[model samples]
Target: MISLNSITRNLDLHAQGNWLPIVVSLVLFLYALFMPKKELSWRDLYITFGIIGYFAWISDSVLGKMLDLVDFGNPKITGIGEFLSYSLIPSSLAVIFLNYLKKTNKWILTILFIIISTLIEWGMRKVGYMKVHGWSFFISIPLYFVVFSFLLPIHRKIIKCRD
Candidate 1:
């Protein structure tokens, strides 16, 4: 008979591989359903899509392939978990953030967003969802800041043009 410890480890590995993405994706879908309504204009959606595309390229092609800074662990969905966590969730949250946040609190929200993202990333590492080789969480902060800074003006321009 297999030892209890071995069975538990195998189950944990399987959960990380197959189940965690489903759980996270479900939570995001639910949050989207219940969040305070804002007009999701085509422009706003385009911005969200940009965020997703940009990060997907950065993480999958640039970071993972080019730089080799990190490896995603045990993703059951043919490596789509990398996109799910890096692109989909963040971009979705960015849409809500852009819609609901007051202009005066933009910087504050940005700071909070970075912190929360970093923590969740760290948690992913702890739970075996993400694996890092030469990457540090600290490196992501500035990169995120840069991406947000670059996107904010474009996002603003889109909303301005639309509304």
Candidate 2:
């Protein structure tokens, strides 16, 4: 059982934390470099990074603000930067899983991922590692469902077209 104070304290401590994301990115970069071209090429990895990063930035930063989903406790521009930074981990992992693992059944993956991600987030929130200002699993679950479901067929089409 986690406490709210602890969670808040942890989040404050890691408010600007970049270590995890940076380390993960480095690992992915290395894997992209050494892995066989057929498994995943450096070019495809870059594209994946670009697409996921951009979408996360737009969805969590730009649209989030427009919809009043979050605020950064600072300037709007800074809020956007913070959102992008915080979003990098999940977004990058998503791309890596999709590209490297080549698992096309994204609907199932999305559900599983969302459930695990949500539980983790909830636990973090309870421990003070995260603060959900305006969102909850009820909101996030459905949103991820729609987003990933839509992406599933698109990813399948892309892979089929490539082969």
Candidate 3:
């Protein structure tokens, strides 16, 4: 019989020291380098980098300290894994919102993003891909929502200005 704990442990073992994010980052960097720069301005790049850095700091320093979500076994190259984990969430959301939903009402998308992202975090916890050593899912969900809310306006402004 496969117990929940056993499943969680296996998932943790599988996820530990994964290199997928690094590879993806390399691909993204290369793609950005080669792509036409007509759409994004220096201000857009600055804002995007700032947002990513802010969220990464929050996730690693603030949230990690509060929730003890740090994966001690996860091998990081110059702390890139930690940064990428947090940055990817907001960056992906920004891309989706800017590319697809700018003209539509944003409230609905905001709610959906919060819900889906929270659920994804919860699922990771359940599967042991994420271990919340000091915090519960209930706490994480609201905290993430708050962060997302704070980031939404910045993302919108940057993307809109660039577009």
Candidate 4:
């Protein structure tokens, strides 16, 4: 019978690194990029994208490097893969989330996005793309919840400033 131990062992043995992060980033970015920007202006999109990317970098640096709560990409070093994954994914997701916020119920969508984000992180860990040292899904869920919950308000603030 295939046990959890066997599966984990196989993963460790086959850890040739995968293209999941880049591919996922590309898909999200493409979808967000090609979609109609009915609710946000070009300036709003640019500002929010930069804000998200900057926030992601700072948060990851503290949590993953300083606090050692997480590890991304290779176990040994930080490189372009880690940087691009951190930068692009969150920025693209923010754009997509903001675009969708217009047509969806904010509360429901926020909760759903949090769940989905947590699952993606969990999958990344399971597939050897990430390692959780001092973190758990519990922490991640709340973090995502707060992040998504704030996104709309932040976007609105940007819009308000633009007017």
Candidate 5:
């Protein structure tokens, strides 16, 4: 006997977790679209966007749902908040990373991106957007490193295929 009102009540739209995902996703999407693209072509942008978005989705699904290492919003249900946080932001991050990567030192920039990503995740956790289970926050440091590190290699492979 689950009512629609009960589901809606659980959303807590006024909470940061409910609204921030949509807002952050929109902002990041706009930024990715309008940001300077001196290092990437339209194809690169599009491909990277899809690849990283899919990667984020897959990784989150495996780690959060399958293995139960974390929870994005409520563990009982998946919603728009989880979608935006899991997909768009990471995709935008890939775009942004590739854009700056060409102009900076690779290892240094990768580390910086990892740190920034970890901090962002910490912020999201603080805002109630996520909950970690069966793992410590420190685990994300290396996880972010792996994700950011892969960005360059993947972009390069795509460009190689195109060229």
Candidate 6:
């Protein structure tokens, strides 16, 4: 049987080490660099980075520190795995998702992202990479909705201002 302690401690997700997420994150970042990008202005970049900041803050500083709700491989960025998996990986996805995704079906797309986020996080949790305390993956569905609420609008605003 898999217990929280076993997963968190033995799996080396938060303590020992994790390689899969770090490698995947690096690959995604490189992919992002080569992906087609529209004419984005400084404002667009700032907004996207802001969204990234919010993502890292909410999960790392707030939930991980203040609320003790989750752990991102490790409490701090002591190695490549922790830095890439916890910080860089999320920000990379945020920048791509926010900058690229269209708001054609606003609510539907939002819900879709929420579902995707939850499922991914659930997988990480199962693998002991992400540990949620006093919270279920279900709660992440709404959390994602909230994050995207700002991300999409800010992205739109930045694009609009540039135009």
Whole-model lDDT per candidate: 0.64, 0.53, 0.54, 0.73, 0.77, 0.63
Candidate 2 lDDT over 1-163, as tens digits, reads 8998765554433444323334444665565455555544555656666766777767766534666654432323343225434455455555545554445655566777667556644544554433456766788778666655566336535644655
Candidate 4 lDDT over residue span 33-151, tens digit each? 88898666677778778888998989988988889988776555655446666888888877777767744578887877887677667667777778778799888887788788985
Error of 6 at 138 (Å): 2.7
What is the per-residue lDDT of model 3 for residues 54-88, given as tens digits with 9 covering 90 to 100?
76666676556655555533433224444455566
Regions more than 4 Å wrong, model 6: 1-17, 38-43, 74-79, 158-163
Give the Cα error of residue 150 in candidate 6, in Å: 4.4
Cα deviation at 125, candidate 2, in Å, is 2.4
Superposed model 5: Cα runs more than 4 Å off:
1-16
lDDT of 6: 0.63
> Positional deviation of 93 in candidate 1, in angstroms?
2.1
Q: Could you tell me which residue pairs clash in candidate 1?
A: none
Candidates ranked by lDDT, best first?
5, 4, 1, 6, 3, 2
Q: Write one digit per residue (lDDT tens) for candidate 1, span 6-28.
A: 75554444545434554565576
lDDT of 6 by residue, 14-100 (tens): 443365567667876775555567544445655665667566756666767888887767654434555566556666666556555
User: Which window of ten consecutive residues has the lowest lDDT sum in model 6?
Assistant: 8-17
Off by over 4 Å in 4: 1-17
Candidate 5 structure quality by residue, lDDT tens digits, 37-75: 867778888988888888888988799989998887777
Q: Provide TM-scores for the models.
A: 0.72, 0.58, 0.56, 0.82, 0.83, 0.69
Clashing pairs in 4: none
lDDT of 4 at 133: 87
Candidate 3 root-mean-square deviation in Å: 8.9
Give per-residue lDDT, candidate 4, residue 38. Answer: 66
- Predicted structure 2: lDDT: 0.53
